[model samples]
Target chain A: MVFRELSLPVRLLFYLFLIVAAVSILYPLTWMSYTSLKTNEEVMLSPFGLPTRVSFENIAEAWQTGNFTRLYANSLLIAIVSVVGIITISTTAAYGLARYHFNGNRALFLYFLVGMAVPTQALMVPSFKLMAILDSWAAALHLPVPLLNSPLAVILTYMSWSSLAIIFIRAYFMSIPPELEDAARVDGARELQILRHVMVPLAMPAIATMTIFYFVFFWNDFLWPLIYLHKHTLRTIPLGIMHFEGKYVSLWSLQVAALSLAAWPPIFIYVLFHRRIQRGLTEGALKF
Target chain B: MANTSQAGAAIPRMRPSRFRLPPGEAWRENLYGYLFISPWILGFVMFLAGPLLVSLGLMFTEYAGFKKITYVGLANFEELIKFDIRFIGSLRVSAVFAFWTVSLAIIISLAMALLLNQRFKGHTFFRGLFYLPAAVSGVAMTFVWAAMFEKDYGMFNQILRIFDFDRVAWLTSIEWALPSYIIMRLYGVGHYMVIMLAGLQSIPDDLHEAAKVDGANALALFRHVTLPLLSPTIFFLMIVGMIGSLQVFTEGFMLTQGGPARSTLFYVLYLYIVAFTERRFGYASVLAWLLFLIIMGLTLLQFWLARRWVHYESEEA
Candidate 1:
């Protein structure tokens, strides 16, 4: 039976269940924020209790001591650079795959699609070795930064892992009618111009999804940074927050505040474009 | 390949004068395609395929970091299969964690999808609210759970103390650590729920209406129509969830560090320890390949099982 046709009690039960689900998801976040404002003594006395006063003391302390400003800058730089590179590479490749009639086009598309199933975890050892090898090569060529412990290592890793982006944008491009591109071609427009003018504006929605998806992916990435970025000055948000917890083992308020800072970007992004993010999740999964 | 060739054949018919063009047209098209995809091909080779081949070779040889390498044919596999207690323990830990987490995620997320699928006011708000956790960064999410599961002053213990129960060591005790890890991982299943909700929406309303018109009750309608239709989504979630669960690292690394007694030594965490901390790159390569094969096997097995239960509309008579 349709939900509207259900008995009153059944409908009420569904509402109750949904309410509980929402609370379970949201309460931890609210609890975290409020607890960050509490004093350590207050937290010890009543761990589950609300803050007595709205205090900026803990957040301020954590920000300075945890080195969050530097971490945020590093994280933002890496995620932004990697995302720009990924989009540029994937969209150009996806357009070609979607619209071209070349030999082995199908083979090339499948080749990328297969990379999606290979987990990054499985490549850790060899990736480390590869980075070491690249470091020597860079040093021989007298490049500025070594690939071993620099941010470049993680950024390059992030950029290289764009199979999903290629696949997603290719599907979106394929959905666009070929007639639009044909029309542009008939006007004597070059392929790049048509891609820039005709295809991109129409593909903004899919691009937006990819931006959110990869931005969050690179931002929250832990293992690669944990491996490649050993220098404290180059630490990203996830690495910084992790070491924050280790440093402030006994200071609950500071730890909570640091975590709250780390959570803000993703939460802010979610609050802003949650509708697209949610739809994107389903579209990626269902379409795959 | 045949379908793609057919599509390619359609291009010539669309442009009648294309046959009069020089042979360089096809060559130019091929060059353009190759140019566009060259970056991906370079990345795939250097980052993925090259590493894969190197790791495959390393799986047999005894190669430590920059140290002289020795050819130890079949020895790593023999040790892992026979004498490595820690490796076996890690496999068991990963299996138990995957089993419980995937099963619970499917049940909880499916129930959530079913609940929100019904028409109700504020359903959209609730969907966003429920999914908000999945959007939180993993490290941030882990810290929040760490605070909640803290022993002396954490939220769970504080609430338990209100009822005068003793504080349980959530991340410390051996028996409790894995369960705590599972609980923390389950907090991020909101994305899975959204996927299931999408699946539910795709099922035609006419099917439900037709079932009701046949004098079916709510349970019968759900049983006969909803279950079959949603099986494919469930199957998808099951395989994806299991694969992710088997490779879980952040929570274990952050919250427990696979400690108190290695009760939470997830497979990936152990691999990290072996590869990085212990500097046994060759041995870790063996572990990495094993994990990959395990995931591949489970995925293939799930796909094989799905043929019996997963109902696709295209397969219907």
Candidate 2:
């Protein structure tokens, strides 16, 4: 066969390459899940073997022992609240940047874009110190709940760090046809009305994409949560599992099960909505 | 800032604005624009700008564990250069890790992207499988990798036994720890691959078809057509990948603690220990500044080099 056409052997080679790639990707994940189900004796005997039985016992034990039920509630609230906050903030900002032609708009767009580069490590100390000060200030002011170990700290941190979503959704808004907006304008639709009725529907794909990205990011994030979340009750899944593993390092099955439990939510979300996720990731990567 | 605001005020009055709404309508539009973007600006001022300024101020002072602060005036940086052996060691480790992992990850990502860009059965499933690692919990990924690299009774060593090879301490030994982590880090390549796939899709098929009709082989086609076309994407990934790998922290934080004779110590991990563990906020600010400077220098250097090689669609005929 010629260069443009694939021959049998070459096609088979491509298939083989894909199989190898897939295995490399899926192996460690399956390894974790399988190891979680295996007994300690079985694990020591054969680390790579499939579990002899498919049991819910490990899942149940990890949930109860790790206090994942409460952690899950806390993590879910933080993630959901953070995503909503990010979307609302970013959508407004992105809509302005993408649709409006005001003065210094480009400069403003670039300003928000700087969020992608401001390393969290650099902000770690200052944010911790700021939140502590805020907590005390709130306490002195007789505020209901202080900001230090509260979910507001995590949510605010995430919202400020959401310039990536702004960039993403802006690109999406930029892609929509200008004629659609013009048509709505001709019909005497106000700006807010056009945004709500016309533009929002057109931008749903992009919004859905950002929704998935922000959800996963907020859910899976470790460093910020570790720094800000001090209370045992406020601990997220990763934090709880981390401390649990430290205490029970010798309990292989429980530790593995906890890790599996910690990894599941995002993985489940990713699998269910991979098409949108892939689209979002690709566009973000391409645009950047 | 004042000048820019004045200029912003001046621009609309002399507008080439063909579809001019009334003055009141125009004023309202500007107000709405400002209102819409207000949240980000407010957040940036409160969270980012304020903290950034505080961090810069912290770099000059000596503050330990939220106690009394004393101004030190660049002494932290001076100590980093003159007396901090662990800091320098971690820098070396991070540089090495970034070099090997970023380049290898880029290549692996490109290769997978090329493979996935082809039309095949189960393409979406394969792509999804490859992209799996990006969504995984960082702590969970670290723990699983820690298990996989266990010295004894690990999956890898069990495989090595088949080839009559002795087991190696993947994460525990100095020689193997960095490289083992590099392998684990390769799992992140799928993310970059998806980016590459996006870039590849943007390249028109006719270019490849023309190259093929010109009697170009697959290798030649990739070299002349695909490589040049994908250069910008490659350059983008290079900058992002380098910046990311340079700030590597999670592995050492969650798994290694920069052990095995400090072979696994990363720049941020060491900084984290200073700030959070030792509670030296001022010194950690110094570390943050150094990391920022190193990243800035490298990013500038990449941009300079990119002028020599990166191809842009707009630059050509």
Top of the candidates by lDDT = 1
lDDT of each: 0.83, 0.81
Cα lDDT tens digits for candidate 1, B131-154: 888888589889899878977767
TM-score of predicted chain B versus true chain B for each candidate: 0.87, 0.86
The CAPRI category of model 1 is medium
lDDT tens readout by residue for model 2, A1-288? 232388879888878878977887888899898888887777767767888977767778888988999999988999999899888888888887776656677787766555666786778899889988888998999998778788889888788876888887877777676667666666777777877898788889888999988888778788888999889999987788789889888888888889999898888998899888888877666554
Q: How good is model 2 by TM-score? A: 0.91
Which residue runs does candidate 1 get wrong by more than 4 Å? Answer: A5-13, B1-24, B162-166, B297-317
Against the native complex, each candidate's DockQ, computed on alpha carbons, is 0.55, 0.50
Count of steric clashes across candidates, in order = 0, 0
Q: State TM-scores per candidate.
A: 0.93, 0.91
Model 1 lDDT, residue B213, Cα? 87
In angstroms, the error of model 1 at B261 is 2.6
Tell me the tens digit of each residue's lDDT in model 1 across A25-101: 78889998888888878877877788878888888999999988899999999999999998988888887787666
